[model samples]
Target: MSQPGPGSNHAPPAARTSPESGPPFSEAGGIPVDAATPVTTFSPVVLEVPGRPVDLRMKVSAPATGDNLPVILFSHGHGPSNFVSSLHGYGPVVDFWAAHGFVVIQPTHLDAMMLGLREADDPDAPAYARSRVEDMRHVLDHLDQVEAAVPGLAGRLDRSRIAAVGHSMGGHTVGVLAGQSTADPADGSDLDLSDDRVKAAVLLAAPGHGEDLAPAVAEHYPALKATAFHGMTTPALVVVGDKDWNAHFSQRRDWHCDAYSRSPGPKSLLTLFGAEHGLGGISSYDAKETTDENPERVAALRALVWAYLRSALYPGDRAWADATAALAAMATPVGAVESK
Candidate 1:
């Protein structure tokens, strides 16, 4: 479909209740909540990239009414499940961001099980690590097209305030875009896919450098062996579960914090107590994969992420400070935030 032109008069979605009125602030850090702005979502917004076998499709969600909205390009994790790895996944995070006034764009990468593409079928599939970074760049290149797809969303985006967020394998994608380095599996050369446009990043349950990978992990995912976070200088918030231990990946449960530890300063880590890789079901709502299905945990995560993004993107915003203080003040906090 052709991109929508400027000056189009598109109707906005209806209004809804603000988040503050719907729930108590005790569970989530007592950050003052704003009146909920309604959200409008557009799906299957297709864009074709040169040399790609399949067309790129994404879902765009934004507040029903807002100006100068920031953009968040969310990359879904690689998984055997077809549904979670597509544009249809991560409603919990995407919806919350949209309702809170950020325009979130999610692209279904080649690795998605829905496409049925395999490395054996094509040597260079979208499922590969490098392609994931390219996919995010393509989304940024077509921001105008994305804005055009959503009614009344034209010229409302704050292109300068962009952020990249991802989960698990998807977190690796964010790390690469935020200046992490890796060696191309095809040719043992260094690969740098960082994009300066990404002002900030969020990596959730992301794997660390491949050097520490266990024998089983190294054999199954050889590409991760070349993954390095030394160049991930961008400001980022790394979230991990204290109990998220994987025998296949590493012997240490704290291995997931490598992104925050290995990366340079201006980074923050949030360790969720008794949480697992699912991180309180951020991937989907009530999915069987969620070992930690506490709604309060999800709520806390959502609030913390939103506050971190707001504070990072907007220098004057103290949402992060207030939220962190509230968390510290809690007699029994769900998690802790540490920055370096």
Candidate 2:
């Protein structure tokens, strides 16, 4: 479904948030929630992967009390901060999703600065790209151990229902999980790692069809320079800041929408006006990386994400439909949800 064009529609979700309101994420637009569960966070859920550069360390967050909870495998972006790229970061996003009843899992990928495991410090290294995807897979393959590691989490997770989410470079990982394909710049072999286990995804500020990369991006990040989403058959909601433009990455900002536009339908796009790469501080709360910091915007993001995943995972749940309707009810929504 073509999303109700962000600024183009006049319906309730149509009130384009001016630059003042800020941008992005899933808090159900303007829906109301009476209460949220308390969250519990566990860190250093170590996984032993022989032959791997380092022991895979991860963080897991979930409601203090819940049963049959769905899981969200969240991938952190390669931010400049020392910790934002680690499992310790993304507090704003992890806490929100966990409190809203998701078992959130975050892995410290090889690209994280704290590990410094990669031979090259380059954030866009192809090796990091491949390792990140494997990290998530490792988590999935060892779900029994992961659940056992987190106190009070075992037997609560609804293993059948799983979704993947990522931001920026992490989004590239989610893209691959959703079946996005591209050539390994080094060997020219196809790199496709789509997982049948992931039912859905939400990619934030993800790179698009890589047709127009900046000069530096082409030379430095060849793996990203040729990303293609034609095989991304998984259903996903692609969230992007209307202003997430970085000349070092691409000549066009809409390149982030390729996950939605270039892929098939059963997808939606949440366009935040005046929002930048950080998508209103999603990487970390009150961090220096967020150029568009706004508590209200982040709140909206939390609600929308919960509702989207809630409905997607549950057969009878109306959270997404209701959330979108709630957004349509708002006269000045921060953004609009257009589905095609």
Candidate 3:
């Protein structure tokens, strides 16, 4: 994979000191904030999947200048949200990854609340979880066209270094791509949707196994009963909030860490001190969904995830090492990292 070479021209503007004066900025892990590459975004890059009812629309963001840039396929979480589930959400993480030398492609899944489609509307609606995985696969299959749709991004992506990231239900979406297996709830047959193309993954506040789910979850999201992670062999980092207790999902908040504990080796877990499902407002700048709206926390999360991605993709990069060390060295650490 091509790494960021030394050049001041790619640097983003210095972060402002006054909180009220400008947008909040977080320090980049391993790389100096001013030394990271600038970003450019192209939105609503539409692609059609044969036999699908709706065209897949995506938002692509990349460094303003660079070649062989790594790709991050981000899946937006399902919510009663309108625009967030579309190509318009998660600006915070998407922009950060792009500005720091990644090509982030975010696709709106069919389960998006914005679509206002109901399970009773179609046979596939009951298989929304599976569709999320297929949406990502479609994105990979049409990477050439997606890149072509965005000027200056064409021919600049490193296809070998792709990572899948998701939040909430989106987490389950990327989990499947990362090797987690599930059974079709309707037929009780194994559903192996893993994609080898995704070299790494990050699951944020993802759901746990079905057997351990809270009673409410089993009653409502019955499809989760088939979730299984024993096959999630890809290198991944699972980030969960210490306070992200979803009474409707699991009896215990730590249940969210199943993706880390149950997955095979070469995995890491990040336990954020006071974070919730939103993980310090990663979904948006100031969306009401963020119960813990700490910019500092969001910054740390971004840096740590970026560092892990850097190390996992490049092999020789010590970004993860430096980032973990930085976190450990903090006088009052915001989180803890453990790997096996």
Number of the top lDDT candidate: 1
Give the backbone clash total of model 1: 1
* TM-score attained by model 2: 0.88
Write one digit per residue (lDDT tens) for candidate 2, span 246-277. 65566665778888888887899988777777
Mark the 10 consecutive residues where model 3 has the least summed lDDT: 1-10
Q: What is every candidate's alpha-carbon RMSD to the true fold? A: 9.2, 7.2, 8.5
Over 1-340, each residue of candidate 3 has an lDDT whose tens digit, in order, gives 2111100011222344545666555565233232567888888899988877788888899999979999999988765456776678888888888888999999988876666553546534533777779899999999989988998888999999999999888888888998887766556678888999999999988888777876655645556777878899999999999877755565665688899988897899999998777788888877656666778788888888898999999999988888899888888888999999
Q: After superposition, how far is residue 285 of candidate 3 from its true place, in Å?
A: 1.0
lDDT of 1 at 208: 79
Give per-residue CA lDDT, model 1, range 72-107, as digits (tens).
Answer: 999988754568878999888788888888999999
